[model samples]
Each structure stands twice: as structure tokens, then as C-alpha cells.
Target: MSQPSPQPDRAAGHNPRSSGPGRLIIALYAVFVVGSLSRAGFQIATRFQEAPLAYTLSALAGVIYVVAAISLALPGPRAWWVSLAAISTELVGVLAVGLWSTLDPAAFPDATVWSGFGRGYLYIPLVLPVVGLWWLWSTRPGTVQD
Candidate 1:
């Protein structure tokens, strides 16, 4: 008798990122994308001459959030790495922007999404990346599962 062809892997449907708590991470990122972009758009359009740096930074933060959310929701190794990079970038951005804004308040007459360590957003921008990085590390493929 001819040997039967092996069945397709059943685990193909499993997506570690978006299967559980990752959903919450993606959701939060989505909210940030909307909030930051909206603020940036309004500021840039209404008064670009007033706080161009702050408005531009807000727009950049919004774009980062969009990348983070999409990568977190997608499946596979590439997406995981993209998510990692995005989250790491976000953390650094928040820290640098926060410190800069704090030490040199004159540099940022208006707040960006990450100004004062996301103080304007209740620090969600500060905390979200930490949580996202933790989640990515914990859910990485090849980990021993129960």
C-alpha cells in the first residue's frame, strides 16, 4: 500500500500575538494611533507656525502606533520582529521626548504625544511599550507551552 501524504500542520491557524492578551495591546495601539494622529493633524493644520516640532512629533508617534498595532495583529516571525522594533522605538522616543521637554520646556511650547513621558495621555504612551515588549518576549515562538 502507498503511504498516505502527511496532513497539513494543524497549528498553522495559531497566532501567538493576537490570540489572547495581545488583542488588548493591539486595541490600545489603535486608540493611540487615532488620538495622536488627530491631535497632530489639528495642530499642524491650524497652527503649524506655533509648534511645528510638537505637532510633527505627534504625527510620528501616531505612525509608530499604527505600525505596532498592525505588526502585533499579523502572524509569523517577521511581524513579531517588526512589533519588537516598533515598540522599542516607541519607548526610546517617549523617554527622549519626555526628558527634552522637561529639561527644556521652551523647546516644546506645546505637548506632543510623548511629551513629558506621555503625561498628556495619562502616560499610556510610556507604559504601553513596556507591556508590548513583555508580551512579545513572553509569547515568542519556540517557548515551552503547557
Candidate 2:
């Protein structure tokens, strides 16, 4: 006499990461996608000879941002795993590049998105992955009790 109920996950507090603050994280990722890609595009196009390594690294960071954003927005266990990988990579990238750039400034005359621990962008790129990883782990499937 009545229609079927919604999915159990929805009825419970097992919300999707794409919802709530997760959306904010995704939005931040989108911003990084634009910033990193545009910067890389401009550098690679107009000043490739000036700083090829930095520009290329920026482009790579942009691609990683794109992947992380999409994976976070997607809904599924597979997507969660992908988001995990992408965010982990981003973290490692920021840390490694931060140290490398700090140690060898000459190697990077310019700056990638991950350089200086994202100091150019107020270090958001450095902290974003940590937040994302925390969000994912906390909101992981079946973890929400309420």
C-alpha cells in the first residue's frame, strides 16, 4: 500500500562525503584545479624555458587536483578508494616538493602548486589533503552511527 523506503544508508547517518563539509573540500579542490592548471598553462606556454620543471610540476599538481575533486564528488566505495589515493598523493607531493624547493631553490626558479608547502596560496594546498583524508576516514562507509 506504500512505496519503498529509501536506502538504509540514507535513513541512517551514513551520509555521502559529497554532502556537507565535503562539498566545501570539493570546492577548494576545484579552486586549486583552476589555479594550478591556469598557472601551469601560462608558464608552460609563455615561459617554459624559464622554468620547465616548476611549470611541469604545477601541471601535474593540477591533474592531481582534478582527480581528487572528481573522486571526492563521486559516490561509491571505489570512489572513496580513489579519493584516498589522490589525497595521499597530494600530501606526499606537497611535503616532498616543499622540502625540495626549500633545500634547492635554484632547481625551482618559479613555484609549483606544492612548492614551499603551498605558501603561494596561503598553504591551503598543504593543509587541504590532510583535511580531505580526515574527512574520508571519518565519513567512511558504515562508520556513521547516528
lDDT of 2 by residue, 1-146 (tens): 99987655654334488888999999999999999999899999998999999999999999999999998888777778999999999999999999999999999999899889999999998899999999999878667543
Off by over 4 Å in 2: 1-15
For model 2 the local lDDT of residue 99 reads: 96
For all predicted structures, in order, the TM-scores are 0.90, 0.89
List the candidate 1 regions with Cα displacement exceeding 4 Å.
1-13, 144-146
- Residue-level lDDT of model 1, residues 57-146, one tens digit each, is 999999999999999988777888999999999999999999999999999989999999999889999999999999999878667252
Error of 1 at 141 (Å): 2.4
The clash count for each model shown is 0, 0
lDDT, residue 92, candidate 1: 97
lDDT of all the models against the reference? 0.90, 0.90
